[model samples]
Target: MIEPRLIDTGTARLRVMVEGAGPLVLMIHGYPEGWYSWRHQFAPLVAAGYTAAALDVRGYGGSDRPDAIEFYDMAAMVADVIGVADALQPDAPVILVGHDWGAPIVWYSALTHPARVAAVAGLSVPFTGVPTRPLGDIFRRAFTDRGRFFYQEWFRAPGPAEEEAERDVRGYLRRLYYAISGDAPPGSWPEKPAGATLLDGLVDPDPFPAWLTDGDLDHMVAELERSGFRGPLNRYRNHERDYAWAQAWQGQRIGQPALFIAGTRDPAAFGFGAYSDPLTVMRPHVPLVEGHMLDGCGHWTQEERPAEINRLLLDWLARPPLRL
Candidate 1:
């Protein structure tokens, strides 16, 4: 059974679901999601004799939500992860795993505090080079020729976006989730035209796989409904601040064993050419890295294919790293 506990990180109280035994493994969930996202992996990891903990990042689930936008900055986020590790294990490092936005936090943590991470794994989102250019420049370049992928612009917009999202949160969140998963309702986005806004592509009605059941969706919706979208949505707004903070580690390299898993159908992978040429950017920084592509999965790799994800994670954790 998974036990829920709160780890006080000085700045915020992180609500975490922990189970299993042995070395600590900390899982971080992505945007619009919480600790529950890793529900499937918790029990399996426990049964396999590993301690697993999934945290509701600050502002999501039961974690403390600070009203200031600066509270959600990358440095603050990294601090929370370290705080969780300090509060729980105190002496030992942890195997860090993250999905989507969670991936970057783990990446930053591993970079900022190398001694505290045993191994690192990222699902759906690969570690791109630290943000060298402005977030606006990156967005403009990524979406310049493709109008269909413009919804990222909305995410970068000011206060009104979060206000609107919080207005009819359930519906807004459902649409956002469906859009990113590429299961938007009918006529959401024509496959032929690649230049659609991210939100536009999310309206399709395709049925998601069993991994992301209606119950799982409801859990996410309920969390957002209670917390309101402001705090979580603000995570996207801090790109510029994050870029500045990451500059300190310009030449730092992540030497730990790293694993990256992506869904074959995940547009984010396709957008960045991670599948066709995985080594181009990521391999240079994270030398000991392995990439896996799940054919039928979407952006939600863990939820869409929990069994496969579990198998991969278990096998990776069981084996010794190349260096050791």
Candidate 2:
């Protein structure tokens, strides 16, 4: 794997790794992960005649880590991505692929800066329109107030989450990756009752899941240990602010060719609120929306099923669609 070099986005300096030379494909990764998360797809995308570039989002890895939680807001995150895209190829639209938080970043970037994005693909997250209410309130009502545990709430606090996770990075990564994988042991992911911690009921599997290797865990841990979990966890504290910022674009559509992929076992695909039907929710905003749900896969869709993902991407990108 090639080492990532730094690129100065107008708002933030990001560490980016590029492969091949052609139309640009800017990849964004999710929470608790770095540019390394998208390493598998870089060569394949380049082989298919596209410039595949993956970058470290702010607050993770080699990117700038702002101290305040507000710096990690969706508004700033969107600006960072737009800046990166513009810096890579000014005024030239690029295809975007993102998973987890990166998914929301690209999705919102498409809406806010439609001219900068030619085509967009979101993994593990679906664009379900602007929320009428703040997500924190909703989550609190559904989980916290109901005497249940919600991961976001547990992460909303700045220091506590960071302390626990950073204190035991290995344990945190192992338990987190395993619990969300396709092979989570039976009863390994039961719902936590009211007043339970995020780590409650989480099991760190014996040999780790097949999708993730010991080497991969080490890499993630090394990067995460450099800059505790503060910046990453701060993202959870901005639900109200994000909803407020998104109000300006209420009822706006993506108006670009888009692809959505998610693992059937991923909670974002079906377990969450009213997000079970992503296509139905996306068609209104993106007219050219095409999607696939991989069976037996989990949160790490690209890593868990790289070959199939490469084939799907090659076929889709080669086919007629929006281009700049």
Candidate 3:
């Protein structure tokens, strides 16, 4: 069982779920997910002889939610990671594992504060080094410029997406989660013109996939209901600001041992990543990098394939660079 505690990051208080005791491995969840997203890996990580700490990122779950959009920027989030690590294990640099938006967060943490992060692994998203342009501009040029629908563009504004998501949190979560999962058919995400909203054409599966149970959906919905969507959606609104802040480190590489995992079917792995070859794009920045693309897997890497991810993680953790 995992023990829950609140970690004071000085800037924000994050609710973290921890298990076992050894070298610390801090896991950060992405958008719309809490510490519970990493629940499947805790036991296996502990059995492999490591302390597994999964945190609900600021603004999600019980974590502190700051009001300003700028508070959720990449720099601020990286500070939270460092503060949490400082509190959890002061003597040694800690391992960091993140997924989705959490992927970029951990990537920036390692990039900006190399001495604080020993090794980093990201699921579903790969680190392609510091950005030269804002992500919003990239997506707009690719999608909105061509009159196509991109979810991030829909999420660019704060109000409408929140209303749609908060109006029926359960339904919104079900569709949002299912549409991008492995179980969904190709194009299950739906095709729409640029004018459409994010949830305009998505469908909720009659019976949700086994990986995400009814109880799981219930827990996620309940969390969102309490926290609201402003803090989470605000993350998307900061692309230009994040890009500006990252310019100082424009040509820098991670300079750490790194691992990347993604599903063949996951759009984020390819579409959003804007590359057919992830390792190629990642290697220049993360020289000592290892990657795996799970067959038929989707966005929710650990959740959908816990056993596989656990084995891979254990094997990687035991590698010479990361081995204690």
Candidate 4:
């Protein structure tokens, strides 16, 4: 059984779901997602002898929502992870794991606080080291300047995004989950002109891929209804700031044993990641990195392929290298 706890991370309180035993494994979900993203992994992880815990990273779900965009900064987000670890394990080494936005947070956490994180794993997004160029400029050049639609760029402006998303929460979630899902038709999440909104020409599958259920969809819709999209979208607003903040730690590699898992079809796998070959791109920054590419899966790696994700995570966690 999963137990829900409101953890006081000193700065911001977060809603965390925890289960299992043995070494601590902290799970963090990405943008537009809450701790429920890791629902499938909790029991399996517990059975595998792990204290698997997932948190509602700051702005989503029952976690505290700070209004300022800057409040959701990388430092603040990473602090929440560390604070939860300190509270639960009190300086004990933690096996850090995350997906999407959470992936980078945990990577940065492990990079910045290696003493606290014994080893780390990321799903979807990979650590590409400090940004050589600001992402905003890159996005503008790649999408905006060329009059193409980019979801990240669409999210940069708070007002329009919140307004459109809040206008129809369920529909928005449906389109997003379906379009980027592995089951989507070839043209589901294709690029569009810059002026288009996120929902323009978006289609929602009649049955969301089996990985996601109506109950799961309802949970996300309900939470989003309460939280709105402003805080969540603000996460995208900080790329430039995040890039600037990382100047202090340039050229640092994640020395700890690390694993990366993502659906082969996930946009982040090749579409958005700096390098089509994740291992090649990540090797320079994360030398110890190893990865698994799930066949026919999309952006939502954990939810899309829960059983496989659990297996990979457990097996990797048990490796002798991670023990030392």
Q: How many residue pairs collide in each prediction?
A: 15, 1, 0, 2
Which of candidates 1 and 4 is the stronger one according to lDDT? 4
Mind giving the per-residue lDDT tens digits that candidate 4 earns over 1-324?
889999998999999998877889999999788999998888887887888899998889999988899988788888999999988788578999999999999999999889999899999888888778778888788878888888889899879998999998988988988888888977888778899999998897786777788898899999988887778888898888888888789888899999999887888767464467777788899988889988899899889888899889888988886642
lDDT of 3: 0.91
> Residue 216's C-alpha lDDT in candidate 3?
89
Ranking by lDDT: 3, 4, 2, 1
Predicted structure 4, TM vs. truth: 0.97
Worst 10 residues of 4 by lDDT: 268-277
TM-score of each: 0.89, 0.96, 0.98, 0.97
Error of 2 at 44 (Å): 0.3
Tens digits of per-residue lDDT, candidate 1, 34-106, equal: 9988988988888888889999999898999888888999999999999998887889888899998899899
Query: What residue runs in model 1 are displaced by over 4 Å at the alpha carbon?
Result: 144-149, 182-201, 204-209, 271-276, 322-324
Q: What TM-score quantifies how close candidate 2 is to the native fold?
A: 0.96
lDDT of 3 at 17: 88
What lDDT, from 0 to 1, does candidate 2 have?
0.84
Local accuracy of candidate 2 as per-residue lDDT tens digits, 1-324: 454678887667889887787898999999889888987898888877788889988988888998887898999989888887787778589889999999989999998988889889999888877778998998889888988888888888777788889888999888887777777754556688866666788987797767778888888999999977888888889999999999999888888888999887888765365566777777887777899988878888888888988888777888776422
Give lDDT: candidate 4, residue 180: 80
- Candidate 4 residue 119 C-alpha distance from true site, Å: 0.9
Q: lDDT score, residue 281, model 4?
A: 82
